[model samples]
Target chain A: MENKTEYKPFEVDQHLTAHGNYWAGKAGSRFFTSLRDKKKLLGSPCKACNKVFWPPRSVCTFCFGELKDMVEIGPLGTVETFTLVTYSEPIQPRTAPFIYAVIRLDGADTGMAHFLDEVEIGKVHIGMRVQPVFAKDRKGNILDIQYFKPL
Target chain B: MATKDKEWISIPMTVDVPYRFAAGGYMTKCLTELRDNGKIFAVECPKCKRVQLPPRVVCAECHVKNEKWVELPHEGTLMNFTIMYLPLTDPTTGKPHEPPFVYGSVRLDGATSVLDHMVEVEPDMDKVWVGMRCRLVLRPKEERIGDLSDIRYIEPLPGQKKPQTKSR
Candidate 1:
């Protein structure tokens, strides 16, 4: 055995690159397209159970029935839960110490996760009323709405 | 049925996942030696005595703990190689290594396993061949970042000539 002098364990840092295409099925397409084009929120209501999904799903998980009803949800929502991110990473959507929130849009039963900005983290709380801040240069993407601000 | 324009759409998105992997006890020892000392280390299986690089805890064949550590030389024989034409993504940086480069595996002397790395030679059959003697070129001590990238590339030793071929 050679001289075993140094004995510190180290972490190997790496960033992986993956490329692929996603086929957002029927309900998903309508949901995303509305965000991109109309700056409106759409939800798919399950025909059998009447459970509405914010990020619309094609079928109801509970009853396993087709969700055919496309209802206009909210450009306004309430903060269901949130966390303050104090750590920064190169791949994050925003800088460190930003607030990420799960918001339940008006008339929708479920919540969607997105960044919360334009309000102090200290001022954010559960059930806080918020509205979407639409970006002027909109593409057909969820980022069409930059972030949610206090209503 | 609705018109084609009424159909659902897809938006292209890129998801980036970054990670930090902990080099375990044996690997930490091996990589640290490579980073600080510019030396290669291997663990020999107690039962079979087969030396494995990137030292592991147990040998697959012998099913015993590998205890003996051996220092391997910098020069090795090229076991196999490939002339890559595609811009292969290097997972370490999430960037593509520019294409049409040569890379290969070299079995170091007295070591059972081979190390795979970029081969610094023209992507030609006459230039690179199996069984060629190559030496590991590492980044200078200051520039060494304690990773496999410390090895800049493997280069063929000087004065090696291409084997003469008979015309068909």
Candidate 2:
């Protein structure tokens, strides 16, 4: 003998919570300021350890020391690694195929991740030279250079 | 990631994220103006002498407050792009924006910056290019808010093989 049971669809709200004031570092005014201008300024480079910092910071990630100045970066660079994104959740417009890659700029010691354009995924390599294309007017932001393209 | 089966059913739903977000003092006022005027805004740093498309309250370079508000040219290049197979749900509308949408970083022409948002286009991966020029399409006035989403998506620019800018 087997027992039969009814399934009920329950409505619920997922209350995801975190502790304390965790400010989104990316949403800060300084970020928007430079991003609007099209300037790609990374976190201050640690003069002692030589680590290229993004989101310009007060201290170095490597030596735990102060970062002195904003470092201008990436008019040209190389592709470090990449992947073709085939899937994402259906929330916005969906495009099945695109490539995302990590790029190491010419002067900086670190790699920045962004989209790779003007080339097929099959043709993308680990060491392709790319450049930043700024918008007509500089807003002083990172998105000013839309993406690194094959140069 | 998992594949669905005959026994599995897909349910569409909406999510809402509401919170008081912070902006720089000068930018806060400028963004408030753009939201009122149905325009998008960004800022430039005087110290580093770089521009930010989203606008800012403080200079990322000198770690000081940047008081200047600068309007950006709507035209720009599609620096980077991605096609999402997954639907990024609109917390406000409580629905997905629709499948096969393009999202990208548009470096606005005049400002030294870029804006990231959804794009309305065919999700053809090969068709997307880094240097592709794009123009901004602003949202209706009533829908305006001092937020990044105020200006809609960026469309391809006209008659330019490469983005219009001096080669750095």
Candidate 3:
């Protein structure tokens, strides 16, 4: 409180930056390496539950089965759902007036979330086939595959 | 693709989160004045009459609302200090101040609470001590935007030498 009851509002711009080294862990390391080096998508399968998760997890979400092995998924995928982001947020990977969609890559049972571009917002629809667009500067992160474009 | 599995990959991430906050009544008045006019103001408790820097709405000890604003002098005493050997990032600017530097709490004249800031001086032990007189240096008016950063640093006043002491 600056006063007993009243005061004018003033804004101060600041940043809370945290620099850290993240261990992508065994499962994430395998997934990211292939994605970054080979320009490929990988998914881990849960045999017990008959599910394959894209952005492969170390273990199955449905069952407690260990998913140590990764199989190549697709550069091609179908849009499961989509939305348009018109407002700005600090955490947003891209600026406002962009599209984000849930896409299920070929050979993967689960949907992976990523940005969608190279298509109009009005043209986007569920089950629309799309392809991954790789970045020129490939850092070993999810953003290495910049966005998904319409096939 | 066949590759080395001996060394598992780890991703290095630096999360830069932008933060914003609204400076309320007393703080807005205080910071705006300091930002625009280069004046430092604090609030005094009505009941106990203790003046506080970074002026607050209530005096916690007195249990009364603060109404009076007091202007403090740029000069004060170096009450406490430490020489940091680590290059630590300043949260306000998201940049690291080079290692081997000095910073301290300075109690400005007419203020009850001490203000903490970087002390501009050599990091050598022989140069700094408690009770050392210091003066607040502020950024030029054109550069100030009404935050605590307006006060650039605290520099030790001239001609003050550490008192001689006997060693055990």
Give the number of the best model, judged by TM-score: 3
Model 3 clashing residue pairs (backbone) = A2-B26, A7-B25
Question: Can you tell me which runs of candidate 3 are displaced by over 4 Å?
Answer: A1-10, A15-22, A36-40, A72-77, A84-100, A115-125, A128-151, B1-7, B10-20, B86-100, B137-145, B157-159
Each candidate's TM vs. the true structure?
0.73, 0.43, 0.74
Candidate 2 residue spans exceeding 4 A from truth: A1-151, B1-18, B22-24, B160-168
Per-prediction DockQ scores?
A: 0.43, 0.01, 0.52
What tens-digit string does per-residue lDDT give for candidate 1 at A37-149?
78888998875676788888878878888777799999899999999999998778788989999999998899989989989988999999999999988766678879999
Interface RMSD of each: 2.8, 25.5, 3.5
lDDT string, candidate 3, A40-63, tens digits: 788998888888898789889988
Tens-place lDDT digits, model 2, residues B71-166: 677778788889987877776445677777899988877666677877656687555668787888878878875556777777776554543556
- The TM-score that candidate 1 achieves is 0.73
How many collisions per candidate?
A: 0, 77, 2
True interface contacts retained by model 2: 0.00
Give the distance in Å from residue B104's predicted Cα in candidate 3 to where it truly belongs. Answer: 0.9
Full ranking by TM-score: 3, 1, 2
Q: lDDT value for candidate 3?
A: 0.88
Better candidate number, 1 or 3, judged by TM-score: 3
Better of 2 and 3 by TM-score: 3
Better of 2 and 3 by lDDT: 3
- Cα lDDT tens digits, model 2, A8-117, are 22222333222343232432334445555546455457779867765456667778886657666666888889988888755433365767778887667778787777
